[model samples]
Target: MTTAYWCVLIAIFLPYLATGAAKFFGAGYGPQANSDPRAFLAGLQGWRRRANNAQQNAFEVTPAFAAAVLIAHQVGVAEQLLLDQLAVAFVVSRLLYFVCYLADWGPLRSLVWAFGMAMIVALFVVSA
Candidate 1:
């Protein structure tokens, strides 16, 4: 598989990373949490709450990224390396975004979010 394809796979699971952090750091996951995970996560505050937000954002953004990569591949962009690089950058930006969210670095998080979206746009442009 191409590097970009691998990145799509990584993006698929990235939200779980943020959620895992929230669960591990905020409080231990228990039966109640397992029963109603959203309710349990909703009760979180501070960094944990931010982590949940990040996870939700990750879920929101991942679909576009995955679609961009797939569409790029289907359309068969000439710059395969460029597509891979952008995919990697998107993943890196997402990691940084998660850190910013957890650390409450609002401005930087927003910038990283923008960067990730730019990468997605670039992917589509390359496909075009």
Candidate 2:
């Protein structure tokens, strides 16, 4: 498996880890809930929604990376160093993107998301 593939896996795993961290820490709580765990549960639930979205995006990239690999092979654009950098950049950008999303940094998160997508696009384009 390529480094990019590993990065993709990490991207998918991060959301779950974040949610788990939220559970371990604490999120939502109210006097009416009659329980402190309720807030934590609510936090987990909210994290689930965000994690699901992240998962969807992560899965979308699998095929995109695979296609890039195939195109690279077919076109003989085997620039291994560039491919490695793109893969690493995609992975790191995705991690940062999710962090920003969870942090609720308006606009900044979207920009990171776009940057990550751009890396994927660059892979396909440069390979061709």
Candidate 3:
């Protein structure tokens, strides 16, 4: 598989990783844990809340990213290197986005998100 294909795989699971972190940090393990998962998520504060938000954002971006990858492959884009570069940019920006969220870097996080979105857009543009 190509590097872009591998990036798609990572993007697929990234949200779950963020969600797991939220669950761990917000509710934790053991008998004392909240029985209601929704309640547990609702009660998240500070970094945990940010983590959950990041998880949601991860999910939100995934469909577009996946579709772009599929479309690019189906269309047989001439620039394989460009496609791979955009894929890497998307993954890296997303990772930084998650970290920025956890760190509460509001403006910087938004920029990172825009950068990731731009990467997705570039994928489609290149495919066209």
The best candidate in terms of lDDT: 1
- What is the C-alpha local distance difference test score of candidate 1? 0.94
Instruction: Summarize candidate 3's per-residue lDDT along 1-128 as a digit string, tens digits.
Output: 88899999999999887777888754464455546766676677888888889988999999999899889989999988888999999999999999999999999999999999999999999888
As a whole number from 0 to 100, the lDDT of residue 73 in candidate 1 is 96
Greater-TM-score candidate between 1 and 3: 1
Q: RMSD to the native, candidate 1?
A: 0.9
What does the lDDT read for residue 27 in candidate 2?
A: 40
- Ten consecutive residues with minimal summed lDDT in candidate 3? 25-34
Candidate 2 or 3, higher lDDT? 3
The CA lDDT of each predicted structure is 0.94, 0.64, 0.88
Compute the lDDT for candidate 2.
0.64
Evaluate model 2: give its TM-score: 0.63
lDDT per residue for candidate 2 within 64-118, as digits (tens), equals 6556655654675567677768878877887786677666674897898888778
In model 1, which regions exceed 4 Å deviation?
none
Ranking by lDDT: 1, 3, 2
**Candidate 2 segments exceeding 4 Å error:** 22-56, 60-62, 73-76
User: With candidate 2 superimposed using the best TM-score fit, by how many Å does residue 91's alpha carbon deviate from the native?
Assistant: 0.4
